[model samples]
Target: MKNEIDKKLTDKNIKPTAMRQLVLKVLTEQKTATSLPELELEFEKADKVTLYRTLKTFEENKLIHKIEDGTGSVKYALCQDTCECHPQDLHVHFLCDKCKKTYCLNDIPVPTINLPIDFSLESVNMVVKGVCFNCKK
Candidate 1:
């Protein structure tokens, strides 16, 4: 299951260290996107610096997307499909209010719209907050 992770890092020129592998392992095994604190708790052996750097590398390589759902906590999720990091497409992410978990809505592709020549947009992340199925039940 984690083999894909190693391959991804290798493809992106990211060296796979023990800590880096653990970070990817955590992300792939996660039920939903996670924040720094959540990840810290998830991997007790991983320090802040390591986790932060891993997240940065993953984001830079377009393997994950950041989710700032206006809740103050910065979250991250796996980039299952094409994202703006590649072609500047909008992506809508879901934030579960009850669990404070975020999930990427990969099926609903982000719409593209034309912008004025004067206005140039680099990237955008759409976030929607609500209770998840488990929380609602």
Candidate 2:
């Protein structure tokens, strides 16, 4: 796990720090996504600002994908295997309303559209909002 994060950080040209590692470690803990505040509360030593900066860095490197809920809250989930900011690992992310977390629907790959000749694709973020199974009662 550490090696994977290290390699990703290096690829993003970001110097790995203890605080950054801790923030990433917390994100990796979930089977779903997490918010900045959620992570701050979960990590006793991580302050809100530090956690946000760490998340910013991670998102910049495509290490994680941000799930945007219409309510205006943002959540994040870990990148799947072979997520090289390409369409392969890019897909619709599901955000459970009740649980207030995000999830990568890897089984459902993102749709692709042909672009103009000069256009180049970088990364994509698709989010589906609803309540998750665990939250349904």
Please give the range of 10 consecutive residues that has the lowest summed lDDT in model 1.
Answer: 81-90
What is the per-residue lDDT of model 2 for residues 1-137, given as tens digits with 9 covering 90 to 100? 99876776777677889887777777777887787777878876757787788888888777877777565778888776467667666788887778666777888888886789999877666778788888887
lDDT of 1 at 93: 84
RMSD from true fold, candidate 2 = 3.1
TM-score of each: 0.86, 0.75
lDDT of 1 by residue, 1-137 (tens): 56887887787778888888888888888778788888889878767898899899888887777888877989888776444364444467888878877787776656776888899777677778888998988
Q: Per-candidate RMSD vs. true structure? A: 2.0, 3.1
User: Candidate 1, which segments miss by more than 4 Å at Cα?
Assistant: 81-84, 87-89
Candidate 1 C-alpha error for residue 99, in Å: 2.4
The candidate scoring highest on lDDT is 1
Worst 10 residues of 2 by lDDT: 80-89
Q: Per-residue lDDT for 69 in model 1?
A: 84
Model 1, 112: alpha-carbon shift in Å? 2.1
